[model samples]
Target: MHFDFTDLRLFVHIAEAGNLTQGAAQTFLSAPAASARIRALEAGLEAQLLYRGNKGVSLTQSGETFLRHARIILRQIDYLRDDFTGSDSDTSGHVRIFANTTAITEFMPEVLAKFLASRPGVTIDIQERLTQDIVRAIRDGTADLGIVSGDVDQTGLEAIRFSTDRLLLAVPEKHALAERKSVGFADTLAFEHIGLHDGSTLLAFLRGLMEKNGYDRALRVKLRSFEAMCRMIEAGVGIGIIPESAARRHTKTMRIALVSIDDSWALRERYVLVRSLAALPGAGRALVDELVQNAAGGRK
Candidate 1:
């Protein structure tokens, strides 16, 4: 219960890096030293934090909860440092955004690049999560803002239109459904599916879609990226649901067909969801401006 900032930060780095040696190196400690420190920390907390594996470590359920609070505390410290040390004209602060998979994979990289170039003291952290979770995190002060999709209920939060998102079924060229121009989400559910990993936001959304339609799906295999999903589909494993942008991009080279998902929820306008625009820090507001301005400039 009496953990110091160093141990908390060490845990964050370890959880993010998924490797003890790499995380230790970030904190300028050796592997053995980091291991001892982690053991001591765990002993003090009386809770296991990480699940060790042959390839790397993953967060236990306790670790996930611990990491969330650790991040909030660490980020608040950074914000406090910036507030007192930063100049009035300088936009210097930390902005953490929780977004869905489409926003993370398709839109954020270039915006982040441009945002970072002019602001020397601004830092950003982006995580993928379900839109419902994103809204809760924003309300609870765990996240500065969020980018969400679909017709999700945002009764309490401010929603700004930033971009559009659509999900398409990626089927192999010779598959029975590929010849069809469009297919309903329910129709696709009966077939085995290839999907992103279990924790991916897109996979979670697809699962929710299935549940909403009162269908149970079997994901034949799970991979890390859209391309991998396309590859699996091409190899006749199963069809996959991927972002329209990704489907178009992958279909040009891969032997896959993009079939529209004929569901209202499949076609969605992405929104920047926040508690209040006026309450955001300068850096956070700047990021919001960046997103909407990009959309205005036809950069969705």
Candidate 2:
């Protein structure tokens, strides 16, 4: 005989509470109804599953074995309902987005504001993470979408071209490098470089570039975020190579200068919109459309 989900749920609940009265209270059923369910489930399987006692209920050896499979089946059904049922309702739901520090601080504000204005019912949770970590978050089902600076090598994710981000050499205004309108790659490398922390796409790209130019062995101090690097540069720690978007704010608010790299090796990295090829919720799809539209407009 096959067991229905109702039976499995009743079995698990009764096993947990150890008493039909409490289990019935939890399921909003009377004790009689709950006891009848337990009996029916045991009889259908042609095995004794429970032992009625003066104090509470206990699972028989057969019940103990069946409980394992029953729990697994019930959990899967719950996940199916969670993924499909909420999709049909209002497009109002939560979207978890992961973005690198640069995109979150600079490129994402305007686009997110516009999206939120259009979908007032949808809530968004944004996390500032490194590019590699952002990809991992999507792969692990923690985030629905991601905006990253470099290529993510993970399979099962589709990355769409969003916008081109120009890299800039950010220096303090009083620094000697600020006198130059543009700096070359070799010149930037000559300074005490304040490197971005590991796991960042920017850091990875920079390391690759340095390697291509036969400067792979060079070492530098590491910092966490571009914002923190900017403060350190202002404090005369070391010059940093940061995204143009992040550099623009420092140029305006602080005693900092943004200089483009004049090397022919300069590359315009594309900011990409990443989504899992698997199922996505309504709010996630809406946000993706908004991102694509915004990207077409150059993310102005």
Provide the overall lDDT of each model, using Cα atoms, as 2-decimal numbers.
0.84, 0.73
lDDT of 1 by residue, 3-89 (tens): 788888899899989999899999888899899888888898899999998898999898988888887788677657656766422
The TM-score measured for candidate 1 stands at: 0.77
Q: In candidate 2, what are the lDDT values of residues 1-300, reduced to their tens digit?
A: 866777777787788789878877877788898888877877788999989999999989998878767755664464466577764322567776878766776767887898888777778878777777778766655566888765457577777666777778888888889988887888776677777777666777688777776775554577777788888888888888887777787677778888889964454545444455335666677777777788787552
Candidate 2's displacement at residue 60, Å, is 33
Candidate 1: C-alpha RMSD to true structure equals 3.7
Winner by TM-score: 1
Q: How many backbone clashes does candidate 1 have?
A: 0
My TM-score estimates for the predictions, one after another, are 0.77, 0.60
**Ten-residue stretch with the least lDDT total in model 1:** 82-91
